[model samples]
Target: MSEPPRRNDDALTLLAVLTDDASRAQVATITGELGDRLLLATTIEEALAHAAREPIDLALVDVGIDGGAGLALVHHIPALRHDARVVAVAHRADLAHGADALAVGADALHLLPLAGDTVASTLAAARSRRLDARERHALAAALAAAHTTRRLYDRAMSALAAGEVSSAAGLFLEGLVAGGLAEGLALYTALGGAAVRVAAIGSLSAAPEEAAALEALARPGGIDGAYAPLRRDGSLVGALLVSGARATSTSILDLATLIATEYAAQRRARAAMTNIDDVGPALTTEEAFLAANEHEIARARRHCRRLTALVLRGCGESSALAVRRELRSSDLVARLGPDELVLLLPETDTLGAATCRRRLERRLRGLARDEGRGPLLVTSGAATFPHAGDSLAALLRAARARATAGAPYVALDRAVHALPLGELVPTLARGTLAHFPSVAPLDVPFPGLLALAEQLCVEAQRAGLATYLATDHPGRNLRAPARSLSARDARDAAPTPEAGQRDVRPDRRAASAQGSSVELRGVAHLAGCADLLVIVLRGEHASWAASGRLANDRFVGVHTHDPRLADLLAERLEEGHRRRNPESSP
Candidate 1:
């Protein structure tokens, strides 16, 4: 009937150690029971040699190989088959060595006085790790996947632009599967605020009214799964829902969950873009774009003209804030890098995109000249769709091409990506085009916050006061605040950060410390400062510091503890404010 299923080539190939026939029998017995393949080696050197020649997925190291040296000899296992999952063999007295074995990457350690059950389980775990090893066919699959992704991405863009959300979702789901997960895939959508299974596969038992159940689950109560709402600017389009699968590890699940979440955002975006095409009984520009490539859209890659890469630079804090102002929940924009982002503009072609690029460049240049500040470069470029081969790589390659072109920004084509909007946001921000908290925005004079920020920094630098400006996220993830406050004080904190929400300057806050503030990512980049002694508050309330379990402030009688950011917050805020004032005459 059907062709035999491909072996899970990713399966573990086991290597067992032994001297006498008894251990060999145990090895064969365990391997057979585990349904794993085996390779035999009598001595440690022999095992190492065999493993080096081919990929040995797991190693059952005989710690007492020559009837001695338990933990010491196990070190050879890691040296030989470095990536192999190991299970250490030990004498009953060597049971303590099990902990040591595991620390060295041994999946599990088995006692010499082994029970059949313990041996099997350890082998099974090794098998699991082997199968899940992110390195297995990762490189190859990743490479092969690289090709289809661009086409898929273009397809996604096309579908979204044409208002074919369902189709675009299919592209996303399939592309994600190709990206890694062997498991079947599905897509969920936000219908009336609830993330429902708009599409799916591999769903095993009966799902209980998934749409309605999911809607209920999204509310205030009910198991209350954390909703990391996906927001572009500040609009809540839909949430990225993650369901737990007991089959995978937490790390694996989280990564998979995020990937799944991205599909949701892309699908929503595609749907939004496509709708311009479907509005009935009207001669619409959206319909024209859709109609141009009607047959070719179905043909997939053939109809698409050029696939261009857009590289948006100078988008630090100020740039991000400006972009955010332009983006709405209904219009999806995903952050691909700290300062780089991808906007899937559907159907708009390249020639047209170039015109749009020029328009944007003119505006930015005008602003830069008017402000008499730093040069702002946002450039874009195009690589023909199939010619560039339409994937993330293709897009990236296209983007890389334009990077050296001396343009601040570039676009492939306007019509290919930009669906003619009924009405675009009049401008990113209003009244004087002042810089927001993003790195850089329109630099015309406005009510200045930068002056205050500058003053604070001068005061701090003059007094040699260490300052640290607190950020909501982008920087929050960059710097994890040191926790010195107790649980109750943190939990009862009030005056929820309203006034602090108004971002002043662009991304100018930087963490300067003689201390150990520099972390895994590097120095914190934002507006603010910190020192040992500092004052803190929320809105008009003067937050008092806590001393030995005694909180000294009452906020409108709510009695909340000072925020964890208490120490240098006032200075950080003031520094950030000073940076926003154009009149400060930097």
Candidate 2:
């Protein structure tokens, strides 16, 4: 039976790849039939180059046109040109003949010498009716992209509304990363009240001086107009500064600031309302495979199990550090922000993890000591793998939400509508966070750290660590925290985890406890245009307690009572829940 007709709403801009003059003319003739949507490419490379610059909704490749060059173009078109869909066009029904094109990457097949009218008609019909088997395909991709963006935005806002800063930051950063803007972007903001570069993606290795120049780009009324008005309730917060020339305009900065402000506001609102804890992220459960061969990718698959994801944002750094330190000291963790975090809960679904999140958040709020501003704010989202989706990118996108712009949202799942994802979409492999479970350590010790005369942990070099050791360590580390590393990047010295390949999940295996532990995490001098320590708890009681009081002059430390266990717990907490929700015990 012939396939049904393609639809009109498909809105695909077709790239017709053909070498034969007659075929090209025929397809050309029918271009108008499909809204003159065809863009002819005699060669594959030209088609790809065209696609890179503009949107090509669909690609039609002539299978017998050349030395598999047409087929090759089909494969590359879908990849390089994300918005471009692909299909194989040939004279016969022998799919085997078109198998190569299909094998590499072909979304649909078409028998050749078909009337140009017929081709256009088929594509048109496909676009209109979901019931037609031969319908060329649906606008699944566009819908998905839009949906993912929306879902991510909503969850982000939920996290933001809840005042989960880093979690919201993580959700937002994911957008920059997926949009391919990371490599050239810089995330600058007010950690508490002072301005600082919170996170950065991309390479500035050779352009340190150039990168340094953009630092001032976030200044108020100093050529950086975007950040000039980042005030909520008459208070100026920090700005998100971008590096490189692509987004170097005041407009871009304006857009960035708008996004950041919306995000910040949503976060503040979410936190004030919930007062109850929140939760989710990915999973981690391959204990056996991890134990057998930590680095053996294939083997780990067998030992892994199911896990969910919890993202917490908007609480900003101080609270996020406390939460991450608290959770990692006890459970699974991944740091998504100086203030945001993700939790990979093994053996639990998103809903289950959310339950735990609620309880935990409630307890955390209970622990809140009033500073008069309000209970710390936090927003959150949850997503699962395989069941939710097979691609890490897709899953994160689908279940996450951003509160920065578009319509306001409260939760992730609420923002997304998972309709049928029709054919023509990319193949997604089921990968696990198991490969890169936790973040690399941001575990930097204070320079020349020593026991001060006052018995506080102080920087031996400047006596600052000693003061910082007193419950508050302020003066942002001009350097990135030591634990600020990628997954594998963080585990250079980790013993092969006893987790299995199948056990690949987020923070499933907690460090074996040696004894009681305590953990503290926070940013310092956040008010008065400086960073502030939110919490300081850990096995190293004296150190953490001391750090809390030395705010702005010292870096906060979260520790437990047991030295070794304390170290393990404290260090682990820093990596949990995307480095947002830290915890400890004593």
lDDT for 208 in candidate 2 is 24
Q: How well is each residue in 405-458 modelled by candidate 2, as lDDT tens digits?
A: 211322311221121111000000111112211212122234312222112222
Per-residue lDDT of candidate 1, residues 70-173 (tens digit): 45446666676677666777767555566676776665666665567776777667666765667667866778886675666666655544444555556654
lDDT of each: 0.42, 0.42
- CA shift of 575, model 1, Å: 44
- Candidates in order, TM-scores: namely 0.27, 0.24
Q: Residue-pair clashes per candidate, as listed?
A: 68, 187
Task: List candidate 1 segments past 4 Å from native.
Answer: 1-11, 33-35, 66-83, 95-99, 131-586
* C-alpha RMSD by candidate, in order: 22.7, 28.0
lDDT of 1 at 76: 67
